[model samples]
Target: MIYKFCPAVLLLILSFSPGNLFFSETKNVKEIAKVIKTSSETNEEAIYNSLNSNQFALPQLESFKEALKGFYILKEKGLISKNILTLIDFSMSSNSKRLWVIDLTTNTILYNSLVAHGRNTGNEFATSFSNSPQSFKSSLGFYATGEIYSGKHGNSLKLDGLEKGINSNARERAVVIHGAEYVSNSFIQNNKRLGRSLGCPALPLELTDKIIQTIKDKSCLFIYFPSDSYKGASKLIS
Candidate 1:
């Protein structure tokens, strides 16, 4: 005599399989949808006020605004989350390399650093880090990640995103936060010029690691400059 299994019994056996049970339990589409929705609601005006209320000069304030505009554009493109913490201001001046950290939520200056910018190459308009193509051949912009190194260069941060324009290839550059003796208020006073980076946003050796940890891994960072051309070119403002 021949016997055949019922179709209902076969279906019951397949449903009890380990693989099917694991797959059904692990898939949670609702949680993923919530995260994406929350990130989309990030407010732009809030981020702008956070940086503007800091102790920035007129030109620096304008640059900060432009940077905020860029951040807003990124938010719209779903490139960043809404929990923007702070915007750092580097005046890029040899006389005063003042750094200000503005709190986005409360619109206040949380931290301030007397940092240094690139030294004068006998060029007044060459105060920016992007001035000398041989030494620092890149424009001022923002980045996501940075790396700390302790080699012959001492302690320094490897800033990413110099090769690609702002918001492009930022993750690949490996830009990092590290300490540098050259980036200090004393350097500006002694040399009448600030220190220059090979393209990195050099900070005081003391605050390098702290800054790096604070703004690493998808954190928003904006480097400012008083250039109308850059402001015009920024898509966030446009």
Candidate 2:
């Protein structure tokens, strides 16, 4: 005489209801995750091999692996939305194309370009990091992309930091991805490094709009550095 919904019924509905799964059953997100406890090393090797075969740089393989680990952790904790991920490898020189926007569904790189760190971070390399408003330094760890808007820098993408004590002051610091003339090949050729931003991961003017459009809403962004502090303090990755 009455309708009742229990835990098992809810799970069943979540698992088998029509249009419940965003990805196809043949290759779903969880299947790609491979989060088994005993198979961690095996999974890491598979991921590394896959990344290499997909044209990602061999030098950045370690960072790529760490990014995947963070992605899996956040995905399991329900902190991510889409399969697309944007990774900015600050460990590389500013003259290099260290920013990568990857499509996890197809395991391909959609965009690879140069990205700028904070002005106060360094000259040709980003060394120091911060999460304060006036620090004028880049922050490390995972970030969830937010809404897009047209601001002083034309079209900009917002970011919400997900790590405590690592990058949680992103909103207060106003670290959005926007275009700048300094983040270009001309600037790098002239100065031997990409132009620095005011603590924002500024992109080149040509690819700004397209990159922002692709990774704008609910995508994952990981600003990676091999700092001991980040490795120890980042709850999202560590």
**Displacement of the residue 218 alpha carbon in candidate 1, Å:** 1.2
Scored by CA lDDT, what does every candidate get? Answer: 0.50, 0.82
How would you encode candidate 1's per-residue C-alpha lDDT over 60-155 as one tens digit per residue?
A: 545556566666556556555543533445544444545555545566655566544343322223444443334432345654444556755465
* Top model number, lDDT: 2
Residue ranges of candidate 1 with Cα displaced over 4 Å = 1-60, 82-92, 118-135, 146-176
Q: Note the residue pairs that clash in candidate 2.
A: none
**Once model 1 is optimally superposed onto the true structure by TM-score, how far is the C-alpha of residue 31 displaced, in angstroms?**
40
**Tens-place lDDT digits, model 2, residues 1-238:** 2333444444544564345454465454354343233256556566566652345454377788788888877776778888878889998999999999888877778888889999999999999999988999999999999999899999999899999878889999999999999999999888888899989999999999999889877888999999887888877656
